[model samples]
Target: MTRRIVEILKKGQPEETITIQGWVRTKREQKGFAFIEVNDGSSMSGLQAILNADLPDYETILKNLNTGASVEVEGILAPSPGKGQRIELQASSVKVYGDADPNTYPLQKKRHSFEFLRTIAHLRSRTNTLGAVMRVRNACATAIHKFFQDKGFIWVHTPIITANDCEGAGELFTVTNLDLNNTPKKEDKSAIDFEQDFFGRRAYLTVSGQLQAEVMAMAFQNVYTFGPTFRAENSNTSRHLAEFWMVEPEMAFCDIVGDRDLAEEFLKYIFKYVLETCPEDMEFFNKRIDNSVLATADNIINNEFERISYTEAIDLLVKSNKKFEFPVEWGLDLQSEHERYLAEELFKKPVIVTDYPVGIKAFYMRLNDDNKTVAAMDVLAPKIGEIIGGSQREERLDVLETRMKDLDIPPEELWWYLDLRRYGTVPHAGFGLGFERVVQFMTGMANIRDVIPFPRAPLSAEF
Candidate 1:
């Protein structure tokens, strides 16, 4: 028996016999006939099977056919007048693989909560909604790789476990040893020692691939890294996650403006790629997930992204009537509310907020001539506050050293980074895009948990 997709079978091919193996979605038995709905993980719509009482194992199949039962169904594909259905299968045989006790199978033929679905994550992928999401996610991931490869950018893999916090944010998951028995540096003064920590000398998960990407950029001129980054922040919001994937690209001989331009182009390319490649998925999301998805993609592709200074963004926010939880100010870091106000209300379009105050921005950001602000930019979308944050790194050795000193950063940890400037650094710039943030923006998903396969936030990492 040949396996066939229900969608393919529904193309009006006459008298076509096919084999479909899937979990039974629903089954209804009558005196003369039995109808069953089955999906083989190929499409949302499943092939309905019509079984007559005269078929072999008529009583046994009917007795076992129930929702959630896994079985191989062999039948002849035919047209159906079943209201919404376009196709059905006339079954001659049923092969049971897994029998589901109706009472034990938690999932049914109805919608379920994301939280509830998350609890049954092991089985959630079987659901139409989640299955579609996973498919879209896989496509997007592939698109990212293809997008970079086509553009002649080298893909670099930065280490996940690192000795330094790239962002200086102090958020890291410390990797440890399994054997608590044989610890290195068994004992130190006061009988307390940390030299035994897995990697030894306080190593932890990487916060960003930016710094390493910078190293690769210097060597290759243009390089990118797409990988997992860990943060230990405890905030519970729709956006924050403990472990998230980031797409970071560093370019040599590029300034802050170049960094901002790259961000805009990269995003536009992703939007175009996904929209063209994942039309069905996007259509489903536009209808079921967010009604504005198509429009959002249209707007992104059709319009030019606006650019403004951080100070200008603050000014716009201050004039607005939006009551922000965090007060808007020029010198302070823009909260998500402030960012949203700028992107959502002020600009009413995708915009780049740049030139943040040196004190508020990262230490590696290049200092402007004013000696007050850093040459940094954050691309903010209407719904998502800050989707991409990047900066033209301080390439001047003296200036970078002074900034590091101002931040009270340990000189030893960044010796190699500083060496880049000392040796041959030529005004490099780069940005980090939270991959999940992009998916959330694309799918209109509200929670970071739903976009990622196995979300490892502050507390949840069970699976």
Candidate 2:
């Protein structure tokens, strides 16, 4: 029989019979009846079922039922006058499919640690916290697609397996299907024996889809990629994940300023959208995670982000008198501490730090007129440091060639990338927004692992 949700049941629905399926959350005893709290997968809040003493299995169901049990109940809707809740179910029959033994079920009525939840990744989703996170994640993803589609942007799918490294960092998870016991020896440790490998060439999972999206943008003018990006960095921090979703938007004729503007607007749109669509879940997070959740949302809608050059950000960091683990320097990459200080202490909000030193940035950043800094911007949020990083790509063929050479990147690896400049190239720019990081910020979740459903990290793919 088809089951109905408790939330959908209205008061005074006179004697309508239906079936309900869910895990039993609570059970209460009464003189003539028992109220069984059952929650379907729809939500955490369960519905009350008043089982009459006349039913043959009422006593058995009540005695056998535990906090978490898979069951189906055939019942009729009735008006509930006991509390603020409007309706209750009057059960006629109960069938137990699975019983959650209290001795084994990790999740009891009380709260559990986020770190502890990671051990039981398979069952974590059923918990109230993870369920709320996944729901908001769904809403945020939908908002991203809607925001781009409404603005006439085409969705581009970039390859997951790539021939070259996108980040230029040697961190890559190599792919091979050859026999490990009899693997061929390579001078450089690359999987060069194409005869045995699956792809027939030195290929690995893509670290980012930026370069391929650039190809699409050259023709489509404006495009975005929403896909998985694998990074093989072994740093065991809460922020780093082996595989994560990256939202990258590339525009054919846009410059650094254009990229910054779009990045700000795009983030604001998602933040606003989630707040509007997932109010109940966000409310749950706000009460459980952070008390300023509602106020933060309201302020985000009304506030304009602050922008400053990377030089200015460093200067602010120096003046703050904060003892940083990594000392601030002119040419050094902005550490997380520096980013947090600029966003929290100096600007006291979301801050855009642009024009980083060319030597410290990636190879694709457009070299500025001064030749010392690159046309780039990083959107640093108050609590979470650098959430977004992007820049106007080097469009000038000669300058790009020089930068690539200086960075020790071979021109042949980026054949099609250079071909864009050789043929029909316009000023293009884009940025990568860490999808898990956004969820963490919005939900006030402490770790990146807690936000994503199945987090991929080094040597830990057990889910």
Candidate 3:
């Protein structure tokens, strides 16, 4: 049976015969023998196979085993005399499934800039940085499921096509089947007739699953949604992506305090799990990608996060000596720079800022007794600010209706959402963590685009 390279490297004993099928990373030829590294994407480090000149068709196989060539090798595991790995493979037979031409293969045995790699996303996964990122990403996904499942949270599947704008940002991508060249317009011809569309209404790709997750939480007590979300924003920055994954968890009877507690525990759980499961990959990220990667993981796992009110956070930012580009005010939302200062420089740990001003937060957030702020909180990490944003949902029907009116949101469109409150509303709470952001944070990847395998951004969806 063919064994995965990770399994062979970790558990295969010396003299044990095994077969591995993978793509070659590098080939070094010597007078008597040749060494080639093979990786199957199971781990960061590949298995080194020693090919002796006496082996049948050694010259042809060695020539075929250029970087990026796929091969199957049957070999006996031997103690590696060289440093780094515990064992190496001594091959008896080698079969090349495909050969990557050294002249045309984009990924040669040299350093390539991330910007250049973005152009060849299909092949970038074979690179060390991207491979380590993917391993860490997989570990994070497993950890998330394990954490929620252990806590008895039901995994909920929410709709991808939604009619209501949950965030009310008005940056929705309309889903229509109508021919744009000869579109059906209203009698006045002022606007396109969405009634002729597929849903008979203006539908859009969902920007979030938080609203649907809330509905599930009301029934299941605790539920979470992990799925892809789309945005139509035209941002071309490294931080923004047109398509990304989200992790949103809602609790039926939870308040802001409970919400804060759960977010902190959730982050620490994922960090700890990744460190234990992918230590080698994490170490590579620390050494090659970012030196503070391990230290960030340690800080998250060891220290207690600081919690403060939004008013206090603003006061601190205002009093600090550092100059900020954005204004430090009570009503305005906190920018990334402000968030980083609080978490990285001031606290040197994760900081949960709560009780945001009402105007800046979404209408669903519960209004504080003061009526000027909402029961919302954001968890900011050292390197990346505002990793998680959540709020205690406003359960009062009267308050919700009034807030909707104040924001000019029509009541009929969200009648189903309003029904949730009219029937049997509870003090529910939840938060959203950008899945890519968490992976980027864990791996110390510079760009959000680098962490995800195929990134979707403005005018950049070739992969």
Ordered by lDDT, highest first, the candidates read 3, 2, 1
Off by over 4 Å in 1: 1-12, 178-192
Task: Put down candidate 3 lDDT per residue, 79-143, tens digits, no spaces.
Answer: 99999889999999999999999989999888899999999999999998899888899999999
- The number of the candidate with the highest lDDT is 3
lDDT for 446 (candidate 3): 84
Candidate 2's C-alpha runs over 4 A off are: 1-18, 186-195
lDDT of 3 at 363: 88
- The model with the greatest TM-score is 3
lDDT of 1 at 125: 79
lDDT of 1 by residue, 1-463 (tens): 4464645544746488777888888888778998888877766567788999888878887778888888888778788867767777888888888788878889887888899988887888778777767766776788788877888899999999888865675567877663557544545445325566655566788998888899899999989999988889897889889988999989999999888988888888888888887776788889988899889989988888998998888788887877888877778898877877777776678989889899887889999999999999989999978889899999999998888888888878889988898788799899989899988888887787888778887778888
Backbone collision tally, model 3: 0
For residue 75, give model 2's deviation from the true position in Å.
Answer: 2.4
Pairs of residues clashing in candidate 3: none
lDDT of 3: 0.92
TM-score of 2: 0.93
Error (Å) of candidate 1 at residue 424 is 2.1
Alpha-carbon lDDT, every model: 0.83, 0.85, 0.92
Which scores greater on TM-score, model 1 or model 3? 3
Stretch of 10 with least lDDT, candidate 1: 183-192
